[model samples]
Target: MIEFHLDGRSGVAPYMQLIQQVRQALRLGLLREGDRLPTIKDVVAKVAINPNTVLKAYRELEYEGLVTARPGVGTFVARTLNEEAGAVEPLRVELRAWLRRAQAAGLDPESIEALFATTFRIQLQESA
Candidate 1:
């Protein structure tokens, strides 16, 4: 199962956090095509957050063409690679901003690498 954690004091909204995590997973080549995600209820239970939050995140992911959800069946990651490659320039800017903030917060490269590794493993297991 994919494990999701929340920082109660984080300035980011729960849905935003979920969206960012999924995006990071995609960018880092963690989740791949045909990878299914947990149901909204399951995500709620795992993250200890409201189901609406998960739904919101899923909606945003859908908007980005990163995932698709069908009634009865759960949401699945998009099978297409480079689906968002056209937006790479903007994404690069965003990544740079995020990296600056992380660096300012004293999160070194090793810690960032570890975070990516852990998230990737969970996503792989969930997809498997």
Candidate 2:
């Protein structure tokens, strides 16, 4: 079973967070076909989020063909999405080191996160 974690302060919508987590899990091999997902009731009770938000996220996943809902039971993983095996990991490691350095220099968590986001957005736009 995959447990959902919502970052209410992450500046992302709750449903998108849930949907992204599912994709990340699939890429990491943490979730595979036939795996049962947390029920809507369970998610609401555990995360204190609206049930419809979770349902909407699930619907989006279903539309993506990554999961399917089995009425009377619960949602289940359907397939794995694309995996960029040769990429991302090294950049992630470097980013982590940079984050640590920022922390050591007395930057608080929020400041570091904001700086990273700003830098990422600017870099993305520049590359485009």
Candidate 3:
């Protein structure tokens, strides 16, 4: 099961946010094919959103062939986006250490994120 959270400040529609979270989970190997998603009732209780919002997200995911809904059971992941699980942990550890170094240099979280985003964009542009 995956826990979902919303960021009201993200400017993304709530239903889209749900869909993105599911996609991100799939990419991160947190959600695998055949895993059951939280029921609409459970998501409504947890996030206090309209049930239709969850249904819409699930439907969109189904359309993408990432998930399927069974009539009386629950929604399940039908495919995953994860490619390489073995490489993620080491990169995560290195990123954590880099974050600590940035904090030690007196950069706040916002500054660190901005720096990372800027550098990431530059790298992408250079590669392109």
Candidate 4:
């Protein structure tokens, strides 16, 4: 089960944030195939979000072939994005250290995110 959180200041739509969180969880191996997602009612209770919003997010995920919804049951992961779950912890530890160093160097969260996004895009382009 995944716990949902909202960042109101993120400038992203709540539903898209939910979808992104699910995708991230899949990538991190936190949600594996056949894992039941939290119920829409559960998400509404936890996040105070509208049920329709949760539905839209789940529908989008279903359309992406990442998950499936069972009527009267719950949504479930259909597949996973984590091909190398074993590699995650080491990379995450390195990322945490890098984040700490970035903070110590006076980079705020937004700045660090911007820097990382830019670098990530550049890396993708270069690799491609």
Candidate 5:
């Protein structure tokens, strides 16, 4: 089973965090087609979030064709976003090196995260 986690201080919305978790799971091969996601009740109970939030996240996944929900059953994984398992390691290594440099430059964890977030947002806007 895939477990959902949230970072309350991450500045991203909860629904978006859930959607990203599903996508990340798909890319990392942690989830496969036909795998049922946690029930909305279960997610709300475990994560202490509103049921509507969970539903919204699931609906977004369905809209993206990454999941399908049965009327009475549950949401199931419908597709994967990645097939290459090794593709993330090089990026992870580069990220680690960047982190090291940031720390050496006297940047704290929060500062580095903020800088990265700002840079990522700009990159996303440019690409779009």
Candidate 6:
């Protein structure tokens, strides 16, 4: 029941929002190995987004080695987190850049916290 939230007005694309949330979950140790993700239809319904958006996000995740998709089955978090730890540095750099941009745009800590809270609830619902 993992629920996802995307800012329709954000300059970021919906699919990119999905991807960033997954990566953020990984970084924060929220999602672990073998966690099952909702099906594309479920994600679309839950997020109130297009099915293609969910599919695109899932496909990108799979490409990044974050999850695996099986035909007739479902997408599962990959057990490669340990192996991928070395790759987190790049993500850290990207996050720093994003933080700088957010700050420059006048998004204070409270605003960022609020955004995270709302999105986290959505994620929890989707993953549940």
Q: Which residue pairs clash in candidate 6?
A: 1-125, 1-126, 1-127, 1-128, 2-126, 2-127, 3-122, 3-126
The TM-score measured for candidate 3 stands at 0.68
Cα distance off (Å), candidate 4, residue 34:
0.7
How far residue 82's Cα lies from its native spot in candidate 4, in Å, is: 1.6
Task: Find the candidate with the highest TM-score and give its number.
Answer: 5
Taking the candidates one at a time, how many backbone clashes does each contain?
A: 0, 0, 0, 0, 0, 8
TM-scores, all candidates, are: 0.61, 0.69, 0.68, 0.70, 0.73, 0.62
Which lDDT value does model 5 have at 91? 85
lDDT of each: 0.83, 0.92, 0.95, 0.95, 0.92, 0.84
Against the hidden true structure, what lDDT does model 3 obtain? 0.95
Worst 10 residues of 6 by lDDT: 79-88
Q: 1-128, model 2: which lDDT tens digit per residue? A: 88999997899999999999999999988998899999999999999999999999999999999999999988999987645756778878998998889999999999998998999899999999
Candidate 2 overall lDDT versus native: 0.92
| Model 3 residue 77 distance off true place after TM-score fit, in angstroms | 0.4
Query: Which lDDT tens digits does candidate 4 get at residues 1-128?
Result: 99999999999999999999999999977999999999999999999999999999999999999999899988999999876878988999999999999999999999999999999999999999
List RMSD in Å for every model shown.
11.6, 3.6, 3.4, 3.9, 2.9, 11.0
TM-score of 5: 0.73
Please give the lDDT score at residue 46 for candidate 3.
100
Ranking by TM-score: 5, 4, 2, 3, 6, 1
